[model samples]
Target: MKSILATILSIALFGGFNDIATVNELKNRAKKAYNSGDYEKALGHYIMLTDSLGVKDENITLNLANTYYKLNDTTAAINNYSNVLSSKDRSIKTVAHQQLGIINNKNKKFEEALSHFKESLKADPTNEESRYNYELLKKILEEQKKQQDQNKDQQNKDQNKDQQKNKDQEQNKDQEQNKDKQNEDQQQEDQKNKEGEQKDEKEKGEQEKKKEQGEEDEQKKEQKPEEQEGKPEEEKPANQDPSFSEKLKEMNISEEKAKMILEAMKNNEIQYYQQNKRKAKKKKDPDKPDW
Candidate 1:
């Protein structure tokens, strides 16, 4: 660090013209080289003036920037122009800002270029070129901003339309789903009702069957006295019941058929009695004769 400081101090303190004649001669040669369009030779002379001679001259710095710009060394030109910005001479500062604006404009930096142009006009307001550049760039930037806003508005409109369409589609889908669900529920309820109806019919049929059996039992009880009438009080026939004729009447037999059935039953009784009488006659007395 100390070495760097010492080197800087050495150049600043001692690297200058010891006499006026040598300095004037170098200045004439640099000017002549620049006027002849020999930028390389002019650049060498300018570097000698600023770096080797350590002349703190703003004009030398500005000229160096011009030469670098002519050589298409934009980085070096910008550095030199920035260095001249702090100059006390308004003409030099205005020229620096103008050059910087031109460089930035070529690189498509509209805002920065316009700012530099405005600064250039502030330093030298009577310069018509700076005024024109500032007005033109400002108008261009305003038009660009307006176009961007219009495009943004159109884009928002399109997005809103798409969103509304999607919302409507979703609503329709939900409505369709609800309709299908209702249909399914109704079908299930109908099936359940049909099953309930079938069960009720089956129960009704069973109940009617039980009722008919009860009525038949009551009818049989009511006919019991009729079947008992006209029977012998002493004894009943062995092979025939008194209820037999009633059974035949209940079978829808004609009156003639009922009499025939009664006659058959009476004949069976007579045969049974004769058989018992013959058995009695065959029995021998204990005190009577034996064969």
Candidate 2:
């Protein structure tokens, strides 16, 4: 009876120690898988250690939440992380809140993510990673608003510039057309003036030719003698007193010499005074004059 009691007591102690050893072994395997980035395998082991190995293991629950987050199962991760939060462990709660915020941000739940980050800061005010992500998201939202406003301003400016350019182009086109019309009118006026001048010059030329012809005809008429068409010469008697002389006798000029001087003057070829002196001497001394 003493031996059987000792055997039973040894078996109970060993069984309790075996349960503790299994819990520790499962936790170690989960840790190794989590560190190696095998989140699915790590999550399985962590869950087993927490739910089946023991219900009072806070550390395993936290590790299980982190493994769920690594597996991209945000819902499960949040649930396990909330379990850690209910534990009232400040360090674990802070870490769990931080991880929950990151998971919520990844799921496009910005409001929930912000709440978790704020709660984390309240738990540990010096959490640099939480502070940085919060400020970055705020800055991104503000910059997006500023960029939208700037784009609207630039679009308005472009439209106004286009309208002003069209106005200026139209004004310039009208001015150019007006200038061209003025130049065309000036050219037409110049042509009309030139035609008038040509007409005047042609009329003046005709008048001058007619005057020159009339002057030539008058000069020919003056050069012709005024002798009658039908007349005869009469015989004259010799002068007995010789006191009254004829017109040619008074000038003592020969008839032949007088005729020659008249012909030279009519031809307009007499160039010297000697031609006139010869004619004057003939008229003054007709008896001594040479024809």
Candidate 3:
């Protein structure tokens, strides 16, 4: 009976020690996997350990958050990191806040990231990485705002230049139109002057022709009376005289002798008158003085 009790006590003690050894082995395997950059294997082992040991284990929770962060799983990393913040260990809480800050900064949540960094500094003021990141984000945001303002100013300057160019072109067009109108008016004035000169010349030529016709008419009228004064008078019949017949009866001559004597007398008278008229025309008057 004594041998059987001893055997039962040894079995119970060995079982307890074996259970502790299995838990330690599991922890060692998980850390080895993480160091080797096998995040998937580390994640699996950490999940199993947490499930068996309970979720309230701070060290297990921090390791799980780090593994998720390495895998780029922001949601799981944030959840596990948030759980680590409730740990009583000051060092663990500080590291948890710093991790949350990095995740929020990567997502461009500036205000949330700054809040996490501020909390991390409050827990442990000597964290240089958090301080440096916070200052760098502030400077980047300021530079982006300045660049936007410069682009807007350049756009306004280009608009003004275009407006001025259009105004100058319109002014030049108006000036050209005015110059063309002035040239047209000058041409019209020159044509009018030329037409007036032509009309004056035509009227002067007509007046000169009429004056020449009136002078010709006056010369014809003056010559007509002078031509009629130069004509000779017609002679009367000698037989018709009564004095010649009376003389013939008084002489008591024969009819044939009387006719012969009358013919002789007529011939003598004609010859005497012609001789006297020639002497009068040929002889210059003795009473007239020589000039």
Candidate 4:
């Protein structure tokens, strides 16, 4: 213990110690702090040593990564662990891969975690932790893929259902439009028929009136000329006698005047009858049926 203390004191006197011995002393101090669970002290010492060394020692980088992980500084831990992957030591590379796999799994990067675990196993095939984690991550990836496929299928089915619904709606709309068009056409046809029927009835009525008028004209043509002349004959009293006395009484005249007027009328009637008899004889047919 006293010799160890003497060596430490010699290393601390920077001017007396060689650079290699000083660096070894720093590494030893950092490792002692880390083993004692004084991660903050170990981290500070390692940082100072890395700056002095001007090189990333594999062991120091690995210890820094572990310290960062313990401090819950995932970004720093991941960066340091990645640097440790370049170490020539297979053990260090295996541990780095394992830590990276654990970090990626925590971040929900299952595929990347699986890949890291596989790389860890390749680096050290006897790493039980890496092998177990690899199998577990593989199963998780498979389950995630299956879940994604189910979601995709469900989306496709929903899309198809929506398309079919839209198609049916459009079809129904078309059918309604056609039905309305058909109704309009039928209404127009009915209106046309109604107008035609009314026109036919008016024409028929006019024709009947014309026919009756024609029949009346023909009847008038068949009548005697005198009858067509519209002359009205005097109506004599059925109970009266055609005598001079009766005529005088009907005229309310004196007997003498009535006798004189009757004489003049008799003369005029005799002359009119003679002229009419001559006209009738002149128009007599030579070839005749006596009936």
Question: Which has the greatest lDDT?
Answer: 4
Q: In candidate 4, what are the lDDT values of residues 254-275, reduced to their tens digit? A: 7778557656776777677667
Error of 3 at 120 (Å): 4.8
Instruction: Tell me the tens digit of each residue's lDDT in model 1 across 44-139.
Output: 777766776677778889989988998889999999999998788999999999899999999999999999999999899987888888899899
Better of 1 and 2 by TM-score: 1
Q: How many residue pairs in model 4 have overlapping backbones?
A: 0
**Between the candidate structures 2 and 3, which one is better when assessed by lDDT?**
3
Residue-level lDDT of model 2, residues 110-213, one tens digit each, is 87887888887778778888888777766765787699889888988898999899999999999999999999999999999999999999989998999999
What's each prediction's clash count? 0, 4, 0, 0
- Can you give the lDDT of residue 257 in candidate 2? 68
What is the TM-score of each predicted model, taking all chains together? Answer: 0.62, 0.43, 0.45, 0.66
Give lDDT per model, in order. Answer: 0.80, 0.71, 0.74, 0.81
Give me the candidate number with maximum TM-score: 4
Give the range of the ten consecutive residues with the poorest summed lDDT in model 1. Answer: 230-239
Ranking by lDDT: 4, 1, 3, 2
Query: Per TM-score, what order, best first?
Result: 4, 1, 3, 2
